[model samples]
Target: MYCYVSEVKLVSLPPILCVHLKRFRNDDGFTKKLYDKVTFPETFSTAIFAAGQSENADCLKADEHYSLYAVVVHMGSTMSGHYTAFISSNQDWYYADDSCVQPSTWEKVQGTYGGYRQRSGETAYLLLYRKKSWNSSG
Candidate 1:
């Protein structure tokens, strides 16, 4: 069962929509990363990964994971060993300034390895389309 938050007109309020993201699970004993089932929307047909990695990866890189490279649609799946970045970070993590909170306009901020590494040039991207929770104040 897949559910999505109401898709408002890009500039509308950011509905309390369900952001479901998936990732590979590994118990290497050295380091482990996992995330909630609901995080980022799986709307992007594009994927991020290592350009030269031709084999398979159901794993997370230490903080060294820099950018998010595009991967073929066929390769961005469970059996393929590719997953969303939120999986490794446990969804409760994100990069914040002195305040420790992502600014508005951030299009559903997500971090690789839980903000230890960034997928967007190690920077947060503005989700210009996403609006904050609306208010019905009179």
Candidate 2:
């Protein structure tokens, strides 16, 4: 018997990381959207996923971490939907939908983690994280 294995590693970590969630998929010649809840942390470290000898390895410092700063949410179905953005600025959260922007809370942002039902609702489509240091001056 023959077996194969593959590994993926991060060659570099940007100051600002953008993560895209795969909520849409093609199945049986049809496009389907997944309403699976995806829990993500407000802050995350990339050191474990980085290549030890890769370029920009210095960014994997022990105190270096990424803090969630923005989230692009999609509300509706696979065919039609509206887009909104949850942005964090100056340690405050704001929700922007079209021309209307309002103050929001972290709990409200977490609600976009999607649901178990097939019904349409706000879902996190893209996430933006900014690099920060655990110590001051981040």
Candidate 3:
């Protein structure tokens, strides 16, 4: 016997995509942080995530790709933590931590992937992706 798994698909995509990950769990009467490793690419197509996407719709084009542009990272535990942001634009990445802002790299952003011994208390909680625009005049 085989079991079928049902998956929810996106019917329409927005110009901007914001993804949020649940990094907290409640056990009994206490809450704890989860450090699961969740990796994502810089760019991806939304067609695979869509159900019965119209082939002729410009918005449904398989060539359409979204690029990761920003991330909101949370550091420390649920009781005491700090928030920071990593932003990418003009081919440059920057890290904003309170009053400090400096240049960063994709490698640094990848560090947000929480797991054992990998930036333990620091993790990405939110992500922002923007769809690429294509010129029709060609």
Candidate 4:
């Protein structure tokens, strides 16, 4: 018998979506890390990723949208590095560096796009997205 391959699509979505990127690679006896830059949006629609999405999903309601609230960043090579976080809450952003946490901005968060190192360009390792909620009373 031979192994068969199949493509599986996402049919449902959770209230929260956590996406982790594989940044580390090990081949033979060499360990390498990827420093490719990936562009993402602060707010996005998940309707496209859904399989057999309901017609209501096309309405683009608040519930179908998501906002980026947190990002776990990695700052060094594959062997040695530091992890930091950028979090957003109540329309304010903050950067957590070790024991220090300070107010930050959207422009600061965009610095994590890691292709070429430039002062504070750290790679994003994990992304946390929270679904937008609407008032039920409305």
How would you encode candidate 4's per-residue C-alpha lDDT over 59-90 as one tens digit per residue?
A: 33323777889999998777888999999988
Candidate 1 regions off by >4 Å? Answer: 1-28, 35-95, 99-103, 106-138
| Native-to-model Cα distance after best TM-score fit, residue 89 in candidate 1, in Å | 25
RMSD of 4: 4.5
lDDT of 1 by residue, 1-138 (tens): 998888222211222223222333555643333332223332221123323333344432212212121111111223333222211122232333333443222233433223333333222221212212123211
What is the per-residue lDDT of model 2 for residues 3-90, given as tens digits with 9 covering 90 to 100? 9999654446788999999999999999988889998887777655653655554444544688899999999889998999999987
Q: Name the candidate, 2 or 4, with the larger TM-score value.
A: 2
lDDT of 3 by residue, 10-43 (tens): 4467888999989899999899999999898877
Report the Cα lDDT for residue 13, model 4: 61
Error of 2 at 19 (Å): 0.4
All candidates in order of TM-score, best leading? 2, 3, 4, 1
Please give each candidate's TM-score. Answer: 0.19, 0.83, 0.83, 0.77
User: What's the distance in Å from true for residue 90, model 3?
Assistant: 0.7
Instruction: Give the clashing residue pairs of candidate 1, or none.
Output: 5-17, 14-131, 19-39, 105-127, 106-127, 107-127
What's the lDDT for all of these models? Answer: 0.27, 0.83, 0.83, 0.76
